[model samples]
Target: MAWGESGELFAINGDDLLTLSLEDQTVETRASDLKKDSPQHLPFSGANILFDIAVGPDGTAFVAYYGNRQLLAVSPAGVVSVLVQSESPWSPHGVDVWGDYVYFLESTVGGRPRWKFWGKDRIAPRVRRVSVGTSTLETIYDGL
Candidate 1:
């Protein structure tokens, strides 16, 4: 869950995006079944794994899907669009935004069973930045 620039709170509930109503303690579904709306097949078997969420200043919500290796943008009207989809071995995690770039940890560790990598070194962890405006992705740091 993450707070938007306008102080609106957003959260993912079982692969669905919901906006929390703090004033009345209500929740509104912004988007549902994200995997069904994805542009490409999300390479995963069980439930969808939504890693992180970040909201931009313009009220666009960013959702990081570990299983799909894609970062999608949900507009205020709940229009879903693929912002950046990594080719392979690079899934977006810990998504956040500052200035014009959305920052995240791009790693291959995602989609792997947690027990296998528990208490072990991550595989090729990287820091990446994507332009929120142009949707251009760039590697800020790679490897150790």
Candidate 2:
């Protein structure tokens, strides 16, 4: 979960994004069924999980999807759009914003069963940083 600029907290559940208002102690849907809402007509089929969220300074939400290898944005107005997506096996997880960049982690071993048993040398996980507006991705670290 991540907190917005206005102090609203956002979270991803299954394939849905929800908001919690601390003042009112209420929960509401920010975006529903990401598969249907994903950009480029790429419907999120199967048990695709909406993994993590990062709320921008303007109250927009950035979400990471492990199965889809995608990063998505939810405007404060609740418009959902894909910020980044790939056909490769770059399974993205754990997202957050720092200044002008959105940072996330990736593991090639992801989406595979019993990945925990895989050798570290075989599974090269990475940390990536990207521009929020331009979506220019950079690999900051790999493995360990």
- TM-score, per-candidate, Cα-based: 0.82, 0.78
Off by over 4 Å in 2: 36-47, 110-122
Candidate 1 residue spans exceeding 4 A from truth: 36-47, 110-116, 119-121
Worst 10 residues of 1 by lDDT: 109-118
- Cα lDDT listed for each candidate: 0.78, 0.75
Best by TM-score: 1
Report the backbone clash tally of model 2.
1
TM-score of 1: 0.82
Specify the highest-lDDT model's number: 1
Error of 1 at 2 (Å): 0.5
In candidate 1, which residue pairs get closer than 3 Å at backbone N, Cα or C atoms, i.e. clash?
Answer: none
